[model samples]
Target: MEYRNLGHSGLMISEVTYGNWLTHGELVDREQAVACVRAALDAGVTTFDTADVYAQGAAEELLGAALEGVRRSSLVIASKVCLPTGDGPNDRGLSRKHIMESCEASLRRLRTDYLDLYQAHRFDGTTPLEETLIAFDDLVRQGKVLYLGVSEWTAPQIASALTVIRELGLRSRIVSNQPQYNMLWRVIEPEVVPLCLREGIGQLAFQPLAQGVLTGKYLPGREAPDGSRGKAGGRAPTFIGRVLGRPLLERVQDLIPLAGECGMSAAQLAIAWVLRQPGVSSVVAGATRPEQVTENAAASGRTLDDAVLKRVDEVLGDLVDRDHGKTAQMMAVKPSWTSTTP
Candidate 1:
């Protein structure tokens, strides 16, 4: 697998990183989880990304168990906070208290002393950026975290944190930003990608297959397959499935033919498309089964020909044009894109 530097940091991560999202704590059992990790490692995937909120921390623990014998220095591990871990009001957000406690908890769960990257899952409007930056800096000083970052942060929010980091002389650098980027969702390109490239921040994308939408698993007219996330319903699953939105569904279905023309699976084309973008250091995809890990890793070194890339742009541009009059600026990086196109 290809490896790239994560921003300007000294650390280098695999082009295709492993993620423990819905698959780890929900879809796969402990044994299957271990197999997935093994498969990824054997395929040269050296990075593993997780969040504290995934399966209420079970994902991290499972990953920890899976990597027991692996050399620590050979891999990069990442996890996130700012998601609710309990029912209480203080259960989430980027308060210093939560950040501190969350890091400790994550360390324990991952069976590691330090994290390669610790990211805030989202912008915490309730907390001062200074407070969050300082707290993160403290973790770096205390040797609990190697680098700090944020997920789903706006351009302004990232800028604000950079200012705070400079002011505080924080040891931890904001090396990476975890955002949802995929063929269907180019939302991050307009602002996030440019900011990251300009500021030298690496983009680690999630949901590159648009939650299997680009896999051609969900057809235009047929019902969603059994055991798919679409069958789950509710907000989170809806966010992943994107099946509830007819417009996005049709657009994703339209791309299957293009994927075929390239002699690649939709999943392969979707992931390769994300890798083609600038400033993307890695794409974090999950695996519920061992075979899936190898399949995704195969897309690592594959590049789309210029013609195919142009075709993809035309398809996306057409959608943007047809959805006109709404001003697709803010919706340019629509969240649904991650679920359908990437």
Candidate 2:
């Protein structure tokens, strides 16, 4: 796998990293999880992404256990905070208490002394940005975390955190930001991508296939495939899932011939499209099976030419407009989304 710098930091992450989100602690059993991870490593995927709240941290533990025999220096492990962990109020947010406690718990679960990168799962309005930065700074000083990152953060939020870090002389640098980016979710482009490029913050793009919508496996008027993500995984949940229904599926079908003409699956074409962007340092690809891992890893080296990219832009115009509008509205109000449906 090709390696890219983790923003301005000295760390390098594999271009196609493995993620333990919906697949590890949800769909895939222990043996399958281990095999998928091993498959990734065999294909030279050295970066693995997880979070404290994913499957309530069971995903991290499974990943840690699976990496038992692999040399520590051979991989880059990243996890996130700011999502709820338990019933208590202190169990969530970017406050010092939660950040410190979550880091320790993640270390224990991952069986690693230090994290290559630790990210804020989302911004917390209740906590002072200074407190969060200082907590991350402390982890860097204590040798528990090597780099700091934020996920799903707006440009202003990330800028505020960076300002705090600089003013306080914090050792940890916000080197990366994780956001959903794919053929169907190009919302990050006009703002987030440009901001990261300007600030030298690398991007570890999530959902490079738009929660499996870009895979062309769900054609219009067809039943949702038995094992596909819409039928099996929980990444997008309700609101986004509803948005990804037939309209998006039809758009994906429109691109099937384009992928076929290029001698690739729609999934491979989708992944290749993300890696081709300028500011994207890596794309986080999650898998439930070893073969899927292999297929995604191979997508790293393939280049989506100018013509293909333009075609992708044309095909995704509706989705791009829709998500960008939603993101703008969300930033103007709340920076995060939560389930309101029972």
Candidate 3:
């Protein structure tokens, strides 16, 4: 698999990162989850991403168990914090207590002494930014986390954090930002990409397939496939519902033929499209089955020429969401710290 340095950091990660967000403990059984992880390894994927809040920490446990026999030095394992893992008031946010406790809990669950990369799952509006950054810096000093990252953070938030880091001379600097980026979601392109490019932070893009919408499986005027994520009846139905409108589905169908011309499935073409962006370091893709893992991993190292790239824009014209304000809107609507758990 193709590997890229995470932003300006010396560490390298596979372009295709296997992530278990909704599928590890909630959607698939342990056996299937293990099989998918194995499939990712077989396809040369050395980066694995998970979050402490995924399946209430079971996802990390499953991933750790799956990677038990593999050489730890050869893999890059990353996880996130800042979401409620319990019902207590201090169970969430980026406060020093939460960050320190969460990192310890994550290390225990992942069966690793330190995380290659540790990220804040979301911006904690309630916590002081300095407190958050200092706490993360302490982790680096303690050797529990090697690199710092943030997920779904706006450009301004990132800039503020960087300023604090530089002024305080923290031991660690932000190396990556994980955001929802795909063929349909282009919100990060307008603002986040430019700022990250200037600051030397890379993007670990998530949902490169728009949660399977770009896979061309959910057709217009049809109920979601019986066993698909759209019909999985948990968080998937709600999360994937926004992009399932008839108009969007119809636009996705237009790209299927274009994908064939490029010698890729609709999903692979969608992932490659995201990798072509200016500051992307990796595309984090989730899977339910082993074959799906293998298929998604193949998108790594494949470059789309200018002709195919232009055709993609022509086909997806006006359907893309490029508004930079959407990032703020998303943060505003995120589940309150008191509401979410594991």
Candidate 4:
């Protein structure tokens, strides 16, 4: 597998990071989850991504158990905070109490003393930005987190955090930003990419295949290929539903021939496309089966030519979502249980 330094940081991570978001403790059983983790390791994937909120923290516990015998120094494990892990007011958000408690809880669940990278799962509009940044800095100081990152944060939010970091002269800086970036979702390209590039922060892009849409499995007027995430009883309908429109599916069908010309599967081509973007350090790929992990790992070192990329843009046409404002829209919504008075 190919490895790249996370932004300007010296730490290197595999090009394809194995992530257990909707799978693991929720969708897939423990045996299948462990098999997928083993498959990722066999394919030379050393980076693993999970969040504290995934499956109510069972994902992290499963991942930790799966990697029990592996050499810890050889792997880069990343986890996120900020999302509600419980109904309590302090059970979520990026406040000092939440961040500190969450980091400790995550370390316990992951069976690790420290996280290679700890990320804010989302921007906490209710919490003071300085409090959030300071808490992250304290984790680095306490050696509980080695690097800092943010997920689904807008460019302006990142800039403000950086400003506070500079003002406070914090030892830790954001080395990465995890965003849902793919051929279909280009929201980060317009603002987040440029800002991160300038600030020396890399992007750990998730949903590189648009949650399997770019895999060419969900055909137009079809039943989502039975076991796919787009299927009625499959995992993550809320996520996969965004790109399951008939017109979008029809447009995605056009990429099949392009993938054939590239001598890669539709999924591989889609993943390689995300890796081609500037400031992208890696693509976070989730899988329920071992073979899926192996297939995604193959896309790590592959590069697409200029013509193929141009053809992709033409085929996708205006179906892509490139609006930078979408990030703000996402941040505006909060879980019903989360208090607005925070």
Candidate 5:
């Protein structure tokens, strides 16, 4: 797979990174999950992304087992925090206690000493940004996390956090931001991409296929794909729900002929389109089968020429519009210092 430097850092990550979000321990069984990870490695994918919140941390354990005997130094292993992992108040958010404890739990589950990158799963509106940044800095100073990142964070939130990190002179700074990006979903292009390109933060774009929406398998009037993520009321109904409508499906079908002209599948076309965008360091995708892994891997080094790219955009038409309000959703959580009383 093709590799790119993560932001201004010296670290090199695979352009087609394997991410297990709704797959392991939920959609796909443990066996399939392991097989998919192996497939990604066989296809030259050296970057693997997961989170403690995924399947309540079983995804990390499965990924760790899948890569048990591989060369650790050759891979970029990443996980995230700032999400609820338990019932208690201290069990979530980006507070110092939660970040520190969560990292330890993740390392144990992943069977690794140091993570190549650690990310915040989402913005925590309840916690002070300083507390979170300082905790991340401590993890780096202690040699537990090499590079820091945040997922689904807006440009303004990122800017504020970076300012605090700079003022504090923290050794750990965010090198990447993961966001939902695809040909049909252009939410991040307006502000997040520009800020990242200017500030040396690269985008690890998730959902290049729009949760299988851009694959054209989900037909306009046909029943939902049986085993696909587009299945009605699937495990990720909330996220995948955005692309299940007929209008978007029709637009996606229009790109199929273009994909045929390019000698690739619609999914590959979607992935290639995201890779062509500015500030995109990697395309984070999840796969249920080995062939799916290879298909995504094929888009790693492949580039669509200006003609194909322009035609693909034209097919998208007004669907390419960006949504400023669609930035990362801020989650609310109760802090350890606060208690609710009736």
Candidate 6:
């Protein structure tokens, strides 16, 4: 696997990070999840990312067990906060109490003393940015977190955060922002990417395959593969529903020949397309099976030429979600028991 420096920091992270999002404790059983993690390690993936709210924290437990014997110094483990994890009013968001408590809880569950990177899952408009940054700075001072990041934050929001940190003379600036980026989801390209590049922040992108829509497995007229995200029920349907349609599927079908010319699978070509961008530090790929892990891992360190990239843009023309406004347009995540969502 290829490794890149995370923003301006001296730390190195694998270009293909293994992230347990919809898999692990939710869609796949413990045994399958464990196998997938092990497969990632075998493929030389040293960076692992998850969130406190994923599977309500079972994702962390499974990851901890899977990496029990590996030397901690050799891996870069990351987790996030800012989502509802319980019913209590203080159990979520970026409030000082919640951030501190959530960090401690994540440490205990991950079987580690400090996180390589701790991210704010989403911007919390309900909480003061000062309170959130102060809490994170406190964690850094206390040696519990090594670096900072945010996910799905807008350009202005991220700039506001930097200004706040500078005004307060905080310990550090954000090193990365995690966004859903793929051939179809170019929401970050217009504004967020430019700001990050100028501010010395890197991007750790997720969903490089558009929730498996670019994998060539979900055909236009055929039923979704038995266990794919298109067929997933419960909270998953809330998100994956956006990419399920004949037009999107037909556009994906057009890219198959491009994959053949590059001597790669459709999924690999899709992932390589994301890696072509310079600001992206890593592509966070989630897999339910060991074979999937192996296949996605190979996409790392591969470069796509200009002609292929131009053809990709031509094929995905109007189907791409380039609207900067759509960056945060998805349904909010909430505690299963809470009446309020964010």
Off by over 4 Å in 5: 232-234, 330-342
> What lDDT tens digits, residue by residue, belong to model 6 across residues 1-342?
889999878989998999998887888888999999999999999999999999999999889888899999999999999989999999989999999999999999999999999999999999989999999999999999999999999999999999999999997779999998888878789999999999989999998987788998878777777888767765665566566677778878889988989999999998899888969999999998899999999998888989999999899887777778767654553212111111
Q: What order do you get sorting by lDDT, best first?
A: 3, 4, 6, 5, 2, 1
lDDT of each: 0.81, 0.83, 0.90, 0.88, 0.86, 0.88
Q: Highest lDDT among the candidates is held by which one?
A: 3
Off by over 4 Å in 4: 232-235, 328-342
Report the candidate with higher lDDT, 3 versus 6: 3
Alpha-carbon error at 319 in model 5, in Å? 2.0
Please provide TM-scores, in order, for all candidate models, with all chains considered together.
Answer: 0.89, 0.92, 0.96, 0.95, 0.94, 0.95
- Model 6 bad stretches (over 4 Å): 332-342
Runs of candidate 1 with Cα error greater than 4 angstroms are 232-236, 243-254, 260-263, 320-342
lDDT of 4 by residue, 182-296 (tens): 8877888889999999999999999898778888887676576765675534348666665667777777888998998888899999999999989999999999789999999
Alpha-carbon deviation at 269 in model 6, angstroms: 0.8
Clashes of 2: 0
Model 6, backbone clash pairs (residues 3+ apart or across chains), number = 0
Candidate 1: C-alpha lDDT = 0.81
Candidate 4 colliding pairs: none
- In the order shown, the candidates' Cα RMSDs to the true structure are 3.8, 3.5, 4.2, 4.9, 6.3, 4.5
Residue 103 in model 5: lDDT: 99
Give the clashing residue pairs of candidate 3, or none. Answer: 56-342
Instruction: Judge candidate 2 against the unseen true structure and give its global Cα lDDT, from 0 to 1.
Output: 0.83
Q: Which is superior by lDDT, 1 or 4?
A: 4
Task: Provide the clashing-pair count of each candidate structure.
Answer: 7, 0, 1, 0, 0, 0
Q: Summarize candidate 5's per-residue lDDT along 1-342 as a digit string, tens digits.
A: 789999888999999999998888778888888899999999999999999999899889999999999999998999999888999999989999999999999999999999999999898989999989988988999999999999999999999998998998887779999988788667778888888888899999998897887888877777767887756343575556555666667878899999998888998988988988888899999988889999989988777999998898787777664775667731222112111210
lDDT of 3 by residue, 174-223 (tens): 99999998876778888889999999999999989987989999888888
Give the TM-score ranking, best first: 3, 6, 4, 5, 2, 1
